[model samples]
Target: MSTSGGRPRRSRSTAVRRRPADRRQQILDAAARAFSEGGYHAVRLDQIADDAGISAAALYRHFPNKYALFCETTSGLAERLAVAIAGVESDQPDPRTELSELLATIATTAIDNRRTGGLYRWESQYLDRSDAEPVRSVVITQHRRMRTQLIRIRPELSRADADLITSAMTSVVASPATHRASLPIRDAQTLLRDVAAGLVDVELPVPRLEPPAPAGLAPSAKREIILAESISLFAARGFHDVTIEEIGAASGVPASGVYRHFSGKAAILEAAFWRASDRTTACITDALAVSSTPREAIVELVRRYVEVWCGNRDLIMVYASEIGHLEPDRRTALRRQQRINVEEWTTWVVRSRPELGAARARYLVHAALAAISDLVRLDRSSEPARIGPLAQRILLGA
Candidate 1:
């Protein structure tokens, strides 16, 4: 390069040159972090490019579009998790040692990737079925491996029991990725490993073998239909992707009729949040009223929570994932209600285990709740009968 004076000047290196493969990986890392922080719809490709220290054109050369990038980022993380599990040394003769080592490895990997590990949890739903299948397959394969080790350790556990326990352990390890709860790295790993290992020996409550009675017909009221359909649509496609017309069509009501029932999509979501909060509060009241001791109250609360969550999976799923799209005032109110719910759990947990300070108790409670919620989302066959007891054990840290 020549200077403006026409004399050849020393060429200045402004930017480091990177190989295409290296730059593509850099983009993936940045995209993972961006998607993890802001979710699928909220993050922009330009922001990811900037974070990767590349231009928008350069990013396009690597990834054709945002959705493609998102799919790769999510599936890539799942593949990484599978590979991490595959790398765990499993030659130990004692299955117990093998299981412990596996859990520890999982905890370490989850903690190490905590910043981006949560992408597959809530955001991967945005992927098309074809793109999502690879991620799902990877996760299932890892779960099967864990379940194998679990079955080896406990030869008598039914396959269903082992699957549930294995799911709970993976959820426990992955729980740290969902929240900002902090501990020293070593302490965090130990805490996760211990909680996961505890689930191996947990005696799951016997599942009900009887078939449930046939469901009754849907509600005839237009307002009831709108709310129910809206929750289902929101849970399945996300709030932003669902339109007022779609909700009306799903409910068999005209758009004009839907307006008479609720103000808009946001209003329906607000109503869903309120509905969940009211039901949860009622459960807490009922639990405390029926229990004479803190431990009893805790167990009752866990059972009630599992019941509520199971009965209203669509509503609860919307409640968990769509909260960010609500208006600030309503979001603030709902978040306050959520904290109150957590405080209720924390109080009972500390009362039952006095040695666990409020902070530690709260952390454990979050992990337990995350485990149940994640399991519910991931496992369609999850039964309240099995979940209630497993959740109770996790909450009590037994």
Candidate 2:
């Protein structure tokens, strides 16, 4: 019998064909749960199969390897999430509000898809060289898309600021699952809203929770101690999603004592960021001082920077975000340092690709710095092999 759509209403055979697709979903769901609750290293295929209410052998028929299945599952989830975020419905007239809806979509979608969220939490690392590069391309496209939309809403935004905010917003939304009992979704939404608003020259008054107790860290160790804690949290949670108290607690310092050393949470963030950025700049700067070829110097600098930071990327997250939150004087100082560093970067680029002028060189440097900055907190520190390839792409653009 023909159905209204001009197809057979149901055949036992056709019905059976649909079942595998559904079962694939079930396996993905279980895998997400297993991966999210515990990361990739800990996930067990047998247990995942059990969670899916299937035998391991059956599951293997659908997904031969755990990593392969995970990448397939999470790739879909990320795409769906990216689409949901891209299609946010809002009419705020303000760029920030629009961006807020978009980010809120990401956070809420993740929250709703607790299993997938867990998968993201657990299996983000499994997206290795092959898996990650395509996703990065998609992300970059989305970034450019959103930035174009933002500029339409607020034309005053500097390309640098737009790029920075876009990067930070992405980090915040994709940050780990929060145990924030009272205000997880709301808080996440608000952070995005405020960031977007700030982009459009609007002032968003958000609450700042009370600062934690000051820690008795020696001057030299204070920064390291904070970096130690912040690296993991930022690496796991991203910058906007993590709080000062969490950093303090993770660092094994009494929350209150941390404030005694810095002015405020943002300022603490500011200090921590500069520490790492300066170190990186120093390494690069020092390399530039002696190396003959600008290209060689740049490569070595990026190589050293990548090696050190990828090993401890959580610190880089703090560096990436914290600098932006500083006071004008502090921000100026930090920017000045970065500017001097960029001059070297610009020189290298101009020499290698003569068509790319100083302005383009600066943007290239910024983008590369932005990408490399993320490596600090990578869970698999052994991903050193990945960094040189990334460095080449970012700085050289071939």
Candidate 3:
């Protein structure tokens, strides 16, 4: 603190200086973690700022609102995945080689960004059309490429079969997003790569021919349309965020018209929830009725489950995400139905794999469900023909 000629020395703060661009990048990274962990509607800007060790004002200086922040988060994720996939050389003469390389890359990317990479599972539906289109294009293009490679690797597999195989493979690689499990990056990459390769190499039996479309009368067209559109809107925006007026408009009806089919907004959600639950139960019941043995029953159950999932992804997605918003009676009813489905699967699993015991069988059944749900979670569902048999194979431990 002494200076020459008795001049006083000025004290300076010791904080390290970061460029604005570096700070902005830090904010984006923090936002990604927050959005992935808590979802778009649940997370607050100030919370993100706190996580980033910055002020809310500083956060806004970089991104105007939560919507913009989410758009950036999703766009960044899509860009990274696109770049990683693009680096994969798909023209290799050996199709499995190409698949192995792609799986390694995807697994590594997923592990490295484990906290954020899986946000699309629950958050992507909330994206606006303008933002969703680019992300969707990136994801779908990658899917198509994988499906093409799969078919090339196994020419005997039908296109639908290829789609399912590719979806299952991708789901295995992206499994970390939904769970809190941790693994060393190298370990995760190796395990996921092996699983994806194994999934790709399996030769599943041909699916039983699907029964004819039922001849029963359909639900009222207007009511069905209203429910369908409402589900879409609810999926894209959290249930609480969407208005009945908006749902009505999306369904091509007046706001008052929505009242005719359902009592109110919550009622629409209840109907959607019940419909998804009821249909899922029916699919399982019908599958069981036709299978002669426990093993056959399990396979048929998974096949029908995947069939239901692909045909009703939006509704199922909405149901999974918004069931908490339903009234207590409807929520309990739906959950009860869901438990029954799980119990049915558990019973069949125990009968088929006696060594697994009831507890292990139950866990595996949930795991199998997770495998199928994560595919939907990651937005990778393709043709039902493909997803169904693949899920059946996974569930049967083929």
Clashes of each: 0, 18, 1
Best to worst by TM-score, what's the order? 1, 3, 2
- Counting only residues 3 or more apart in sequence or on different chains, how many pairs clash (N, Cα, C under 3 Å) in candidate 3? 1
Tens-digit lDDT track of model 3 for 204-272: 656557663564664669999898888888777678789989988988899999998899988887887
**Model 2: residue 166 alpha-carbon error in angstroms:** 1.8
Candidates' TM-scores?
0.85, 0.43, 0.66
Candidate 2 lDDT over 1-398, as tens digits, reads 78898987767666643345589888888887666554564467998889888899999898889888778776877787777866875455665566666766765675567445645433334578778766656566667766766677667767754554455445444433422122345654554344333333322222234542353454457656775666567556655567778877876777776776655566656666666666777787677777788677777777777776755556654444333345557757866777787777778878877876665555556545644554434333324444444444545654
The lDDT for every candidate, in the order shown, is: 0.82, 0.60, 0.74
Highest TM-score: which candidate? 1
Number of the top lDDT candidate: 1
Cα RMSD for candidate 3?
6.3
